[model samples]
Target chain A: MIDLSDLSKSFGGTPALTSTRLKIAPGELVCLLGPSGCGKSTLLRLISGLIPPDTGRILLDGQDMTQTPANRRPTAMVFQSHALWPHMTVARNVGFGLRVRGLPRSEIAAKTEAALEMVGLRGFDRRLPSELSGGQAQRVALARCLVVAPKVLLMDEPFSALDAHLRKSLREELKALQRRLGLTTIFVTHDQEEAMELADRIVVMKKGAIEQEDTPSGLYACPATLSVAQFIGQMNVTLATARDGCVAWGGRRIEMPVSGDLTLACRPEDLLPDPQGVPAEVIRITDLGPLLRVALMTPQGEALTWLTPRAAAPLPGARIRLWPRALHVFRGETLLETIQPQRLTLEEDA
Target chain B: MRRFPLGGLTLLTAMVLAMLGPVVTVVLWAFAVKWRYPQILPTEWGLKFWAEVLSRQTITGPVLTSLALASVATTAAALICWPAAFAFARLRFPGRQLLLFSFIAAQAVPKFALFLSIAVIFLQLGLVGTFPGVALVQGLSAMLVMIWIPTAAFRAIPPALEEAAFDLGASRLRVFLAVTLPQAMPALAASYVLAFVAVLFEVDSGLLIGAPKVTTMPLTLMTLSAQVVVQDAAVLCVMIWLPCFVLLLLTRRFMTSRGIAEGLGA
Candidate 1:
């Protein structure tokens, strides 16, 4: 387990990471998910002892490891670029840490082979990093860190180097390996789907600070902030007046919190065509392989998107009534209420 | 310039040949037994002067001295430059670019001018005509190379490779030895060759700093060229060019591993 207490860092008088607190469990895979310059990499570097934190205490397995050098700590990182020593062969790269520990040659040799085997590269011991394909080299890099049997594994966008298909397969393969090893891992990536697929919990970071931290589904369904709602997925938010735990927008009322300056936010998937709902003119329906992304303009001139079956979407310029199955109400950045479909049914009954 | 497709190519070839012109002249001079200033080619050629230069103990001493001094200078410069280059490449300082520029500028300034000014101190310290002093003086002329080329080479090494080594629990020293140094090897090799060749061919520093007592190969060749027998200087030139020719042949394989170049660009 690692406890980051009040961890903050600044580069050139500009804050890279704000005072942040987080607890990572022993065997949990947590992804620091964010776009570029969001301090995800900064936090990882601080934890790995690559850079000194401006202020913080990092407690690793109940020890104050903030001052400990990266070498002394039972932690290892697989770099984003896979950073394999260009000169060393696959076996030697895997055995590097053991060699540093001054382990006997035989032991290092045996373990290196085992590590190569573990990463499914048993015959790749003699190959230099340049000889390996992108996927092969990535495995070798993984084997290199895993050979040391580190307590925590930090991966910084390891799959970002590969093509789409390779990225997906390697992602699954790495996820399986992480589970099998039962290692506490901190994976960093900007790709939301990759985070959702791999991480047990995703920490959404923005502007050097975490916006929200939760399970993928939880974050998707219950985004606490307007940015979180918009960042997590395609969310359509419209200005609405809240009254008596309900929001009035587009001639229809959402049963939610009462506020003067509340905004109704709903994911593209949550918006569905209904006979008795707010009116909209379908602008275009784009085929998105699994679903058609329906583009619409409401009577109030609010642009909206809804993912529906190709057959379900009305043709362009056709009028359709739509209902938000769930509406997340946010006043400024704060989420006020989550009005479900039952509230709409209850409002209909009333 | 781009109006004609082959115009740029012709210009580039002319520039390359212009640079190689003196080198080609030296090679031709090495074989020329009887060549006058008015004539373009030598009237005659023979290996007789080669045997005479090789047989002479006076000529061989400076040849050996030149070899020894170049080796010592190369080693010393490498020791000084490795960490210096690493620091300049990896670390951030207020005046890094300025300092790098100043050092690189050291290469352009003639060493004879610098040596002349520093000779007073060397004379006072009783190191003026000594082998160590001469070699050390020769090293200063090539200091920019010892720092600059390797600095570029080490800079070409990705910082991530070192970080990965550290992440795997290797100490700073181990990272330098096992990871960083190896990555910079090709560049270092190329730089070492350059430094060695630079020291070997240095002319004025030996006369300015190591005059009277010490004799270097370039100095010996200079004196040989001043002699009555023109063929003797030609033979000495061949002797000087031979080893460097072999070194150049070996250089291609080392330079082909452009890992450092790619790393720096990245």
Candidate 2:
């Protein structure tokens, strides 16, 4: 368990993270997800005691660790760069923390070997960091942190340096490992897909402030703000006027579940081809293997994207009737609610 | 490859002779028992001057003095410069660049002029003719090498490694000894050997600050050469050159794999 209360940090008079507050439950894997310079890494450093917060308190299970130095805190960090000591062989690198703790040499060796085995690197104890591949080096870094048996783990974009295929496999392995160990983790990353795949709860940050925090599905289904919606996945947003529970768009009036002028957004997959819906010109088509994406432009010049099975995809320049299967209504920047469209049996009058 | 590159080979041979000729001549002189004009080589070779050097205090005392001075000065410089080098490499403070440049600029001014001025200061401080005075001057001359190379080596270590050590519960000093120092050891050792050799052979500071009281090997060799004592000078030259050559070879053996040049360049 961890609690960060009103934590703020600044570098050279520039605020990296503002007065931020977060609490994580025990054995929960929380992700700090954001674009670069959004203060995700700063938050992780504040928690790890690598950098002192400008003003706040950090509590681990009700113990105030705000004044504790990194070495004195019951936390470990896996850096994005791996950070294994180049001069030490893999065994020494993994056993360094135990050695620092003044553990017996035989015990240190046994624990180090077990930790390496946990990371699936059993026979790599004698290899220097330079001798291992990128992924192996990362596993050794992980083993080093795990050997210390800290109360919490802090990983700052640990897999960002790997190739895409390697990153995915490592991400899955890390998630499985964290679940098995039941380790409380604070993972910082700019990768949305990684956060979606690995986080129990994703805390989306923007401009050094928490934008939204929710489960991966909750974030995708109902984003708190327009930016959160845009960040989590592809969103098709357009403005429309709502009056008396009816919405007007693209020279056609459609019945709505909500009233008042609002910005509307829908997922591409949620926009279905309907007989009695707004007409748009298909301007481009994208092949996505199993699915095809149709980019359409309304007569009013509003752009919309629709995903359909490749076999049912309309050709470019074709006119298609588009209807929202579900609509997310927003007033300014905040999402109001999601509405399911009712099937209409009206005849086409165009 | 086809022609055996005779032209290149001839040029290389000339360069090697140019470099080794004086050294070979001095080594022969140190062992020559009887040689005169028009002799292509030493007519008779023996250890006569070696025996003379071993027996005479003029040679033996300077050798001991030189070794002691080099050890003291190099240790003192390393102790003073190491923390300064780490600060230069890691910390951001006002006037850091200016301070680092001052260390380099101190080496650029002609040593004789600088030592002359320092000697004046030493006289006022009542430090002249003292071993500490000589050691201080030698340490000052060695600072550029001591600070620059180690600073570069320290800078080359990823800061994340230190942070990781801290995250794994290593105290600052523990992290330094276990991680930072070992990684930078090769470059640091190379610089130490180089600084020791440079101080051992230093003549200007010795003449200005240590003329009568502190007689180093180079100062003695300078005296022998001025007096035209060829065999004694040659013997002293070989003695001075031997430690430097041996230490350099040892340093090279270790540094070849560690990339000390990369550390310095970094």
Candidate 3:
């Protein structure tokens, strides 16, 4: 287990990481998700001891490792740039950590071969870094870290340089490798879909602080704030007036418990066209093979989108009606209302 | 239709011939047995002049002396330049820009003016006629240019390579030796060659401080020029130019192989 408490760092008088705390269980794969310049990489550097924190205590396996340098720490990082040494061959690069630890040449060679085999680079031991392709270079970097048998593996956008198809394949490969080794890992990225697909738990960050941390499904289904909802996926926020167990917006009222002003969120796929639903006008329609994105303007001039199985073949400037479920409500950054799912009663009981 | 500009090619050929004319004339006169006033060509040709120059023991000693001094001076300059170049490329200490500017200024100043004072200092230290004294003088003058050009080359290397080495648990020294130095070898070789050639022909300090006791080919050529006719002086001049010519040939070969000429659009 690794724990960071009150971690903070600054570069040239600018705060890179503010006071932050996080905990990772043994063998857990947690991802730090944020946009660019959101301080996710800074946190990883601090944990790996690449840069010392201004104020913090890092505990690994119940031992204080705050003052330990990077070489002494049982942590390794695969940088976003893949920082492979161009001068060394693949085998030497993988065995660098062992050589630094004063291991025998035979032991270093054996461990290096094993690590290379683990990363599916068994025959590439004699090749220089420049000889490898982008994906192969990343695999060499991963092998370099794995050879050390570090307790915690830190990756900072390791797949960002790869093409989309390769990225998907490598992520699965990395996940499988992590599970087999049972290594506790911290993966950092600005990509939301990657975070959702790979992380057991995702930590959403904004600026220098974490906004929310939860299972990927939980964060997606129940976002904590407007920022979290918009960052994680497509969100259409509508302002509404709340009064006496009902919310009213754009000339439509929905039955839900409300206490004050509120914001409503609905996934694009949830909204649909119904002849007897609230009146709306179709603004634009885009077809995307498996789905269609339909944009509509309400009578009060509020714009929204809904996804359907087929393109709505309505003519331009046609009016339509959409019935969407009641929005999850939040008041002043606090969860204020959740509408229970409506149930249809049987006529036999009646 | 546009006519081909034979005029430009004619002008370029003329420029090349103009540069080669004087050296070609000198080599021809050096080999002639005799030439008199108003004669465009020699009256006779023989190896007598070459034999005279080659057989002189005094001339041979100065050639050896000059070779030794230049070799030692160039090697010393390389030793002093490497670390300074590395630091100038990598580190940001206080007064870095000022120090770098000082080295540039040292290269700008003419060596003759500095040699006068350096001679007095050498005499005071009782090193007036020694090989080490001449070498030290040449090294001091050549150090700035040797170090600065190579420092720029080293700076051009990607810093990512060094960072990668460090992340792999290598110390700073190991990173420098394993990565940075190998990448900068081509530049370092160029700098050493340039410094060696510069020191080989240096005469100002050597003549000013160690003329009577310590001798070099350049000082000997100067003496021979003053005593003999211009035709006789040509032989000594050709002899002195031979080694530098060979060195220039070697540099040209290196420059071609390294694509430095192509890079410069030469």
Candidate 4:
């Protein structure tokens, strides 16, 4: 287990990470997800001890490792660029940490070979880093870090440099390795899809502070803030007026427990076609094979997107009504409530 | 079967003649015993002058002194500037750009003029006509290569490599030794060789600071060319050029590395 408490850092008086605390269970892989300049990388660097935090305590298991140097702490970081020593052969690179620890030569060699086998590069020990392909080089980097048997493994967008196909394969392989090793790992990436696929829980960072931290489905289902809702997935929000447990938009009213200036937010897929719903005209339709992304403009000039099954998608220029299956009620950037409405019966639609 | 490229052939010939013409003339002069005016080649050729120049104490002493001066100056320049180069490459401090510019600007000034001013300072400090004074002056000429090439080489190494070493449980010093230094070695070696050759051929500092008591190879060669026999002077020139040519040949690969081209801003 690794625990970070009250971590904060600034570069040249501009805060890169504000006060933040996080805890990761042993064997859990938590991804720090955010766009560039959102402090995700800074947070990762702070945890790895590459840079000191202005105020924080980093605890590994129960030990206070805040003052320990990066090398003294039981943590290893795999960089986005692989950071392989170009001069060293794969075997030598993998055995470097053990050599630093003054282990017996035979033991170092044995552990290096085992690491190579684990990363599935068994016969590639003698090749220099320049001789390897991109994926192979990253595998060697992984093996180099794994050989040390670090208590915590930190990866900073390790697969971001590779092509998409290789990135997916490597992500799966890394996830499998993380599970097998049961090491507390923190991976940083800006790609939400990658974070969703790899992380046990994703920590979404924004503007030097964590915006939200939750399981993938939970975050998608119940976003605590409006920005979190907008960032996680494609969401459509339209202005509405609320009064006495009712929200009204586009001359249609939904009975919900809310009052004051409101915003109705829902994912594109949640907007269902229904006769007794808010009316809009389809501006465009994009075919994505199984689903159609329908662009609509409400009467009040509010634009929205609806993801519907291809067979049920209306043509462009067609007037249609959309019933939000689940609506997130936001009052001034705060999610007030998530209201789920039941499907209308056939008789009611008629 | 294929027609030769007339333009390329002419350019190649011109380059070969332009570059090799002086060396070939020097070699002939070193070997010739007698050659009359208007004669295309020497009437007699032998190693007589080579033996005479080799046997002379004046020639051999200056040759040994030049070698020592070049070696010491180049080594000392490297020792002083490598850490400075590393700092310039890695650290962000006030006046860093100004300091780096000063190093580059040091080489741009006419060397003799610069050495003349430095000689005056050396005279005030009682360092004139001393080996240390000559070495110090020669070492100044070496500073550009010793600093620039190693600085560029150190900069070219991604910081991630060092950080990776640190993350893998190596201390700061160990990371530098095992990771950073080895990566920069090729450029460092190239710079050392280049500086050594430059110092070896350097004349102004040897003339300005080591005069009266200390005479180097370039200084001796300059003196010989002025009044000594042409054959003896040519022999000394060939002796000076040989080591430089061989050293460059040995370090050619390193010279081709990015550090040299980038450091020189080529």
Q: Decide which is better by TM-score, 3 or 4.
A: 4
- lDDT, candidate 3, A47-85, per-residue tens: 877789999899987889899877677888898888776
Prediction 4 global C-alpha lDDT: 0.87
Tell me what fraction of the real C-alpha contacts between chains A and B each candidate also makes.
0.80, 0.76, 0.22, 0.76
Interface RMSD of 2: 4.9
Off by over 4 Å in 4: A243-245, A279-283, A287-290, A313-319, A341-350, B1-13, B32-46, B227-229, B254-266
Candidate 1 Cα errors over 4 Å, as ranges: A243-246, A341-350, B1-46, B251-266
Candidates sorted on TM-score, descending: 4, 1, 2, 3
DockQ of 2: 0.46
Model 1: per-residue lDDT, tens digit, B21-51?
8777877766777788888888887666777
Alpha carbon deviation, residue B226, candidate 1 (Å): 4.0
> Model 2: how far is A126 from its true place, Å?
0.7
What would the per-residue lDDT of candidate 4 be over residues A1-350, giving only the tens digit for each residue?
88889999999999999999999998899999999999999988887888998998899878998888889888898899999887777898899899899999899999999999999999999898899989999999999989999898989989999999999999999999999888889999988889989999999999999999999888889988888888888889777787876666555666766578987788999988877777789999999999899999987778989998978968799999888889888998788888885432222211
Error of 4 at B134 (Å): 1.3
Local accuracy by lDDT, each model: 0.84, 0.88, 0.80, 0.87
lDDT for residue A161 in candidate 2, whole number 0-100: 94
Residue B92 lDDT in model 1? Answer: 94
List of clashing residue pairs for candidate 4: none
**Highest-TM-score candidate:** 4
**Going through the candidates in order, what is chain B's TM-score?**
0.81, 0.90, 0.84, 0.89
